[model samples]
Target: MTSMTMLEAINATLRDEMARDDRVLLLGQDVAQLGGVFRATEGLLERFGPDRVVDMPLAEAVIVGAAIGLAAAGLVPVAEMQFLGFSHQAFHQIGAQLARMRYRSQGRFPMPVVLRAPFGGGVRTPELHSEALEAQFVQSPGLQVVMPATAADAKGLLQTAIRQPDPVLFCEPLRGYRLVRDEVPDGDAPVPFGTARVAREGDDVTIIAWSAAVHVARRAADRLAEENISAAVLDLRTLVPLDEAGILDAVAATGRAVVVHEAPFTGGFGAEVVATISDGAFYSLEAPVARVCPPDTPYPAGKIEDYYLPSVERVVAAARATVKAP
Candidate 1:
């Protein structure tokens, strides 16, 4: 076991993958000389050389479009959007081209590309740097969206994303890059998708979340435990291949649930969780499914980000309400 921060784990994973596979390469603005805006690619440039760690111009569409071309040719290209919000510029390539390549070719082409972007509020970044857009990206039929909440998951999930045949939108929480740390396993075994990790066990309500919201939910569960309100925390690590069975199981065990995420409440991924529970575990539900998220609005500026992101207090309140509902 190794203790490392989420950012360190991601850096190590990239280094390990690049070393393990000759075809694995990286490209993005500042990914070479600058070693990535957050240094997630630090030391990789010297180790892998410019041919693999090439830096491109500041064009999101061009970067993703190029990645599709690279993947179709045979090399595995990991494209990075400086901030996830900037991916709005590459929706054409991401949604239309890369996502549909395999289907468009009738399985003739393999879109083995990994798009990495960091998001979530905190650290006071500028506009478009902290928008939690996992819900929006997962709408593409063939694309997979993964968000890791811990250091260990960061290493394992990224390995899976890199090695997988389809395109994966790897959303790393900026708040957790340096803040979250844990014991990561020693091997290269990738963590499979469509599975949820049980962060805590309880029989009252299951608090479902992903990315930074998982931490928020876990903290809320701890608070609820003090008051004798047992709450289970389920981290839905991947949103695209959502763990429907895991969710149904958690809800059946607890008979109540509160979905949480950094995205807004209106159409956030939390709504999908509630619907999944309502659809699959309806008979077991003891109360109306609840959602804990920010209001339906654009991500706010840095000054008021705390008010915008879902807080542990809000999660606890929602869990308490779900538990008390008759």
Candidate 2:
């Protein structure tokens, strides 16, 4: 096991997958020579050469459109959008073309492409740099979405998504890229989608989250423990193929749930989770599932962004509400 940052782990996975499969190729802006703005693609250009690790022009639409053509021609292309907010430029290509290729062609062609984007706020990036747009992809059909909270899951899920025979929207929390470190096992370790990990077990309330919110839930769970409130933390690793069984099970055990995320509360991924629990575990639930999410507004400037983002106190308050509610 080696301790590595989430970015390093992702880079290692890309390198290993490229080495294992000749068809796997990476393309994006500043991916080759510049090693990406976050250095996630560092050392890849030298290791795999320019052909496999490519640096394309500064057009997300063209990059995604070209990736669609590449995938249609029988190559597993892992395309990167510099930031999640920029993916809007390729929505038509991704949502209309790449995602619908298999169904449109009746399985004659499969777009085995993984669209990777560094997402979420916390680093206080400029206007559009720190957006959490998972709900955009989640609402769209024909695309699988996965977000990893730890370095291990980041590496494992990226490898699995690269190998899957469909289009995958892999959202990596930018805040977790360098903030969290974990010892990842060597060799090919692919964590299957639709699985959730229990970060912490508790009986008071279940805290459901993904990506960076998983860390928030964990911290809140720890804080709750001090108050004699046991909060379970469930990391919804993959959002689209959400672990419905795990989520329902946790809520059944705890009898209460608090869904949390950095995304805005309105129409965010948390709504889907709350709906799912309401549908599947309504009878088992002791209290209405509450969501602890960002306010429904544009990410504030750095000065007040901290207030906009959900904090441990917010999560703890939600947990208390869930427990004390009639």
TM-score, candidate number 2: 0.98
lDDT of 1 by residue, 85-133 (tens): 9999999999988888999999999899999999989889888888898
lDDT of 2: 0.92
lDDT of 1: 0.92
**Per-residue lDDT of candidate 2, residues 266-316 (tens digit):** 999999999999999999989989999989999878888889888999999
| TM-scores, all models, native as reference | 0.99, 0.98
Candidate 1: give the clashing pairs. none
Model 2 worst lDDT window (10 residues) = 133-142
